[model samples]
Target chain A: MSATESVITTQKRSIWAGGMSPLKVTYGKLMMWFFLLSDAFTFSALLITYGLIRYSYPGYEGNPADFVFAPDKWWPIPEKVFEAVPFLHGVSAPLVFVGIMTFILIMSSVTMVLAVEAGHRMDRAAVEKWMLWTVLGGIAFLSCQAWEWSHFIHGTHEGPMVAEGTTFFGANLLQNQYGPPPFADLFFFITGFHGTHVLSGVILNIIIFYNVVVGLYDKRGHYEMVEKVGLYWHFVDLVWVFVFTFYYLI
Target chain B: MTMASEESKTIQVTPPDKAKIRKIWMTALFLGVVTAVEFVIAFTMGASAFRTSLFVGLTLVKAFYIVSEFMHLKYEMKVLIWSILIPTIFIVWLLLALLIEGEAIFMVKF
Candidate 1:
């Protein structure tokens, strides 16, 4: 081997400099991946905090089966607090509406995947079509969340009222009709944080949609942008899965 | 600028795979089914410690599936996967610390 070649091969190197990216991924993808990981930490902290606080509170006293919608205690059941549906008020359907919302978010994630697939095929029309549908799905989910929030604000007909020494009725940062104060606070905080993410994702999708219509990707001859957005959209969907379980189901 | 007028930015393009399309569909269906099962279990099952653990386990399954399939993490190299996942171990530490602290708070006051 040539002396220069031998020296080059044998040179000691710092680990980070030796290989910038062993995965051979683009900078954009790497950043997005790390970003999602950090985001997951914040969510993990919040959910774990919920668990911590939940176990500390003295829960309702009665047979669990008979109290599906009775949420007036130190540690009320989530289904009891969130059983109301918009316009179908008084007709109790435990977790039914939230289930629909979950499916909606899942459907949007599916469309986002389709859009990324279209982008891979260099089909501009298909990309635009699927992206638009994805945006619509985001809006639908936000609307559902808004309805849910309003329903929560209106207070349940069966609430024990805020004046009661044992149960605090109505919701604020300080108190809620549901069980302990932390229950409502965490619900509002976690779901509100998630709702903000959905809003931001929708806004991002709109920007992407506009770019698609303006032929930005057409000129560039690739739609890795769509794929990046797909990553983000799917992350939102994934987060919602956790939120639904920890906040509603559990 | 000395760039040629006829030249344009180039990128590698691969043809779409029909199998991938099928895979996406199956993933969505699987996630949907899992969610539906979670709902069923929630309603039918009594509130117990076992029920909570079951829901949490199912949730993790769904989360892993979405990350692998929809986020395409399955296609990534091992190094990248490790980088993203290993940091999450710290979260377990955080949970342990906080839960103990929270229990202490309960013991002290509420």
Candidate 2:
């Protein structure tokens, strides 16, 4: 490396090694990875705890695997229970909508990656376009989640014969159409926590999107901000993979 | 140093290479396909013991991609990898043991 380049690299290393960087990454990129690692542990703890609880309460009913339209002694299957949309009555899209949401988030993550790539290329227009797409993706995912939560809360009632200790939204801690307690409680707690993460991720994307538009990172010279956010965005997507497997699939 | 000036100075640094950028995108595509396959397996297969095993296996595949590629742990230092992995293994073992014990307690109570 040239003298100036070598000096810059050494200075960067020392600054990061000593800590006290606002971005936490002397490279800005490495700090994002560290943050993502800690975040992974958080999601892992929640998911593994969900698994423990799920296994402990086996055969309670409302099997996510084999769901139906109406509630029975068996738990409403996950696919069946979460198969409707808000205000779109009589449309049965079991897991289809959530699947779409998943793809959307994944695609947004792809766009974010591309933006990071563009940042690396110093292609200002490309970065701007992809960042905009990424932000849109986040918003779309959030909207879908909102619809899902609403559908879950305002569940459809079939009969007047109320099953004591049974809830409209399948088995929950408060009560369920099937299964024991802790099932619903765990479901709410785990999925709710993940939803909150998605919400924060959306907010962060918006902030980054704004920054990108204003040419904050472009003027500064490095696209590490994009890289950092890209890590976080991917991490969110990563958490969803586990959640989909444990909560819905298995 | 003042925060504003420091921030400005940091922003002045240039971006990385095009090859690294392309690598990230290619890795993401791979992750996407793996995830799709996971969903397909989960949906099509029956819940037999073997199927469950397969599902777990696929889940692991997806997890590997997310950790190694998306999270870039694969490129990280060996010490970093071991530090994370070892603790994760211990935690998983502890969780399983506790779950088994917890189940036993539940059976006794209920």
Candidate 3:
């Protein structure tokens, strides 16, 4: 071949020549990935803000064993504040409820993967089964959060006195029995944001499940739709891992 | 029959792989165990720099599994993986900058 002709042929064969996907995915899937990447940035920004606000406060400097929820401490110990579980009032069960919530999210994520796998095999019945389980898990996580939020709102009976004549009760945007205002504020913002994502994920999974039952994807000759939604569901679970680490574990 | 039914008839469906499903469940079990360990540390150990680092490290590990295995990012093309992961580098820089600023503010106030 002539030199110019060879160059032209190479140019036509380039991955970016617009005939094939360089990313090896459909246009819709690629868009979903980009959307998730942007969402990750948003979540990271919120988390970074939480870290900054948290660091700006004067945290407790005393012995960790001697830590207690007091007005003077600008950063109340997390375990001490988040010790309540459902139906077990006044019991100090540190990290148990959140642990369950984490497991639920992770389990749901696993089911989502299974659904995607089933979709790949064109197993409509299997996809429906796993998708149903995933939706239920999402709902379970949301219910757990609602209970946790209510418990936080209903502060402990022995809440510390914030002022000489004022005893701080539950938490709000303005005030909280917790260490500082930003503490409760960040908790609400971060977890509430994550919860919103989970809620939407549940809704999307339901729609996908309905479509699966109707044999829409089966008729369409591909279950790529389930795979796309699976990506979103897994991203939700991934974000929760970070949230659980920062908000609860740390 | 309708065109849709005719199209569905021509589509090839792979039989389900038992091993893949088992692997997915295994990953779920691993995540559960790691979370359980985190709880154990929370209750047993006091707040310290070391403990915080451990928690962050474990969290990253869990995130890796979710993104790679469950999200199927590992199976994607390298160009796609890099495109998604590279932007997160800036998030690390943002975190470091804001944390230093926050600590400085605390020092000034206290």
Candidate 4:
């Protein structure tokens, strides 16, 4: 080859190498991590706000252990108020359902990790399978959360005593049911924000799943998409860790 | 034509070993056991100071494993690790400061 031809060939080779190189990381995954980091701040703000509200309003009428919703007074005990379904009626399963939701999210995170691993191996089948599981897990968690929301919204209220936008757990802020006005407002705001995240995650996972099935990522010869979604999924799981702690355990 | 052949060669490589798969499963199982312990402690133990401390401690343990293993931060560069850790520390500090201030405001208002 002529000297000029060799130089051009080398340049072509370098460009080819760059284009063909398997991406160990992708811009999408990096951006997802950044998104999760910002989301962490949002949740931290909400939870800290909750703590402040709870701490300042100490010695309200009801016991934190056995709290009941009274229009005049009472802070709804996290345990008493959150007892929910799939554990059957008359059984004290407060926080149990939320606990299950936590587990589902975490397990799905595990599946996401597996998908990333599969991506590393270039194992298309494994990626598809695990991504499917992760998607299903996200859906299951959203369903449980939706049920929890409905239960909160339509809580037991009797005639004459019943008030608009008021539920059995506590008094509504926009309207009064149980304890103070801010209680319901904070509950809706915090949990609503988290639910919105779960919704977006579900949508994201579905997109990733579609990408896997259609072999978009396989053609690109990188599974960084899976890794990025894994990061996001894990972040969602981590936020729940704090939620389970401060909101439920503490 | 040459580039196409090179790409084909790379694509045809075999999968990783079963040992790696086994290791991944073991790590996942360990995470599961840790989660079960967390559940037990949260449910069975009374809401005492000690229980609270223990719960927080176990949660940190679980968080560490999830971040290091599942998120593959262990094999990553120190710069990456510090990048995540430093921000997280600042966030916690911010949360504490804000929480205290918020409580004071609430006390004044209520």
DockQ leader? 3
* Candidate 3 lDDT, B1-110, residue by residue in tens: 58766766776778888889888988889999888889889988878899999999999998988898899889999999999999899999999999999999889977
DockQ of 1: 0.51
Over the stretch A1-250, how does candidate 1's per-residue lDDT look in tens digits?
Answer: 6999999989987566855665778789889998989899988888888978976766666786565323334577788777777788588788989999999999999999999998888777788999999999999999999989877766777765554355544677776666567777888889999999999999999999898887678677778888888898999999999999988987
Give the per-residue Cα lDDT of candidate 4 at B57: 84
* Top-down TM-score ranking: 3, 1, 4, 2
Candidate 1: pairs in clash: A162-A169
lDDT of 2 by residue, B57-107 (tens): 777787787678666668776755675567667557766776687678558
TM-score of chain B of 2: 0.67
Worst 10 residues of 4 chain A by lDDT: A157-166
Model 2 CAPRI quality: acceptable
lDDT of 2 by residue, A1-250 (tens): 4998888777645533654653323555655665666777777777777666555554434444444433233333466556665566777766777777777877887787788777777666677898889878888888887777656645556412235553455344576543345556766787788878878877887787788776677667766777777778877887887787777766
Q: What does candidate 3's lDDT look like per residue over A24-140, in tens digits?
A: 899999999999999999999999998888888877778867776665556887887888788887787888888889888998898899889988888878899999999999999
Off by over 4 Å in 4: A1-27, A59-66, A70-74, A157-178, B1-10, B102-110
| DockQ: the better of candidates 2 and 3 | 3
Estimate the lDDT of model 3: 0.88
Q: Superpose all Cα atoms of candidate 2 onto the true structure and report the RMSD in Å to 1 decimal.
A: 6.8
i-RMSD values for every candidate model? 3.3, 4.8, 1.5, 3.5
Model 4 agreement with the true structure over A67-183: per-residue lDDT tens digits: 445544444456656775753755667677887888788888888888888888888788899989988998898889888877666654331243455334423556445445666
CA shift at A5, candidate 2, in angstroms?
23
Could you tell me which 10 consecutive residues in candidate 1 chain A have the lowest summed lDDT? A65-74
- Badly placed stretches (over 4 Å) of model 3 are A1-12, A161-163, B1-13
lDDT of 4 by residue, B3-71 (tens): 644554566435767887777777777766776787787667666769867877877877787778888
